[model samples]
Target: MKNDVKEFFDNSEHRPPKFGVLQGVKVVFSAIEVAGPLGPHFMAEWGADVIWLENVNGGDTNRNYRPSEHEHRNDRSMSLDIFSEDGMAVFKKLVKEADVFLVGGKGPSFIRKGITDEFLWAINPKLVITRISGYGQEDADPNYIDRPCYDGIAQAMSGYMSQNGTPESPMPAYPYVGDLFTAMFSLSSTLAALIRARETGKGESVDIAMTEVLMRLSTYNMVDYLNDGRMYPRPGAKDPIQGATGIYKTKNGFLFTNILGRKQMKTLFNMIGCEELYGVGDFKEGFSFINLNWDKADYVESKVEAYFKTKTNEEHIEIFDSMKVAAAPVLSFKDVVEHPQYKARDMWVDWDTMTTEEKYKGVNVVPRFKVNPTKIWRSMPHIGYDNDVILEDLGYSEEQINELYHKGVIFRNDRDK
Candidate 1:
């Protein structure tokens, strides 16, 4: 794997020397919320020049998500009202330079705001256009085309909520259901498009519906219903396929442990001082032995629960670690933030916010890179913070920039304030 990653960098023609992975790649984004912003955020983290275009007023809604001590939280955004001719002209210029364009939202107003895939493709034939929406790009139902959706709606409709949590404790999970998965798909498709564009000078359009992404993720349950003719209902606490594995309450908190086979079961029993169950009755036949009679599972789980209750969470973790048993203590957000593993991996990035003059921190990029080290250059920018510099770099004169700002086509918060 290391060799493959090394080869990928060594053979790449456009690899950046500083970042060593992505150097000159540019992305123009007019996306909002988690679905669209996340994909481009990954690109930006990996050294892509991401220009975020937003409305002249408040900018992307994600800016107001969870404000950190940092000035602009940790996102990068700029204010440019693409509805205006000047704004459209600036956006077109960016499209000509960008390798990818990510768009979100719906309605004719979106097109009027210059976010249409066709308009983007017209600017640059090689532009990889990734459009994210609620339902899908296609649905015979008239309301589906321009329908607005949030995470909760996607979760309920995709049956994700149905399968998640206990049967009695059916509730929505915190992290947005389809958003992260959709972002992953979007990022994967963008990378694939980049590869294609590199080789064939052709870029394709990628349409990702959050509902579809969620549906694909819920395939295991869907497959059971379709292929095996079995309706897979929610299994509370216990996994249906792996019966003996579950979250067990300890003295301190919850701990998860799984003993799949009879050998593993024996190991678990021995670790917990229940070695008597090894050769007793039909248990000697192992997992296949116990699986034959469903009644045996209850007997085994009762024994396992009895053992788990004897030790505190820390003691159980140590015992499991020493025994090479698959066990983990369920950690809360606070625990995770202070986890030793995350600290060792440098998974949290700290940045100083210009507004607060205090350091704000958050989770860094997913999947740490060894060779091309990822670093947070700065905190996410305030709305239109980089207008002058960006406009100046794009070859717009000071007077022209001021005129555009005054015309309400471009925005700079400092100037506005």
Candidate 2:
């Protein structure tokens, strides 16, 4: 209560010498896995004062996974038994000063735990309480609202999986798109709510459902069916309606081309020695020749395939560039890391992990800002690493802090094993 936030920044060793655009904002997030924690990680990079609340049991389950290193950075970890009386007291004090609080799990679970919006708004009137879940907080069926779900389940339930991969077998998008997309939605909504809260002096609660986010993303795929009742067959890696937009084998490797515009389509038809196909594109001024020749899809693709087989990757690149065709080589992971464009953009950066002191490389702060630029001032932290400093900031003495730790209200995980 006595600690001035500005004064702490001026004196604390943890403070970065140069902060980001979110320097004055405070965010406290209690998240379990990737879906919950990743949202706040971006805010932390942008200089928000972020505290990650971890359960005393063993901290976030993500800590056991590989991507955990990338998921948690620029955060102070505080392991606490929030279900306990003393722990809730400490949590309430922290929430009293926070601008945003994000939590992950079913809505019913939090309500059962008595951590509802009303309880939090009583502490901080302008707080933006954000909840991340699989199916959101409400539904026509009460049973569905409380159903436990994860990334894959959301993908399957949201129709996202049905539209992906081949018709033979559909596959879920890799690297947890369900979780990451939901996190992105949650971040945007919370920031919007925070802005309104600052202006009108009233808080907002944002409920983000992973399934809903995926369904929204699939709008383009669903619009045709919604209006005309047409369900096109899955085209695998190819565009559903555009025959010329697909991956083709080159002399050396594979290249994907999306020949949509009239000029690009004409260039492809002429180059493939099928100039007669160009006349088929008389539908409109901006119509694509390949699209108009949909009836001759097999013949057109065969010609294009034969033409591509005559050229190497470098030759195809030169031809595409000269013809202004939208095409690129289908790169592998190694090729991506060694790509010249990524290096020129300073995409890769190095940082040392706090606990292991091990060096790691990852992408830098994205969509670089020209002013008050974001930065990675610190790497991932150990569980409850800043317990002393954080408690001290809350006006707790060293003796009281020790007693709290002894009483199991404060906790830390030493992953020495």
**C-alpha lDDT of all candidate models, in order:** 0.69, 0.79
**Each prediction's number of clashing residue pairs:** 0, 0
User: Per-residue alpha-carbon lDDT of model 1 for 11-60, expressed as tens digits?
Assistant: 11212224525657887777777877788777766667677777898877
Question: Which 10-residue window in model 1 sums to the lowest lDDT?
Answer: 3-12
TM-score of each: 0.85, 0.92
lDDT of 2 by residue, 1-417 (tens): 211112222212454434677888899999888788888988887778889999887788888775687777678788888889989988998999899999998655776789999999999999999988878876626767877778899999998888887878888888899988988888789889999999999999998888889999988878878998867666677776667678888899999987777787767777888777566543344456455236677687778789989999889888888878778999998999999998777777766775565676777776566666676766677788667778888888999998888898878664232
As a whole number from 0 to 100, the lDDT of residue 45 in candidate 1 is 63
Give the top-scoring candidate (TM-score). Answer: 2
Candidate 1, superposed: residue stretches over 4 Å from native: 1-20, 67-76, 107-116, 268-295
Error of 1 at 225 (Å): 1.0
TM-score of 1: 0.85
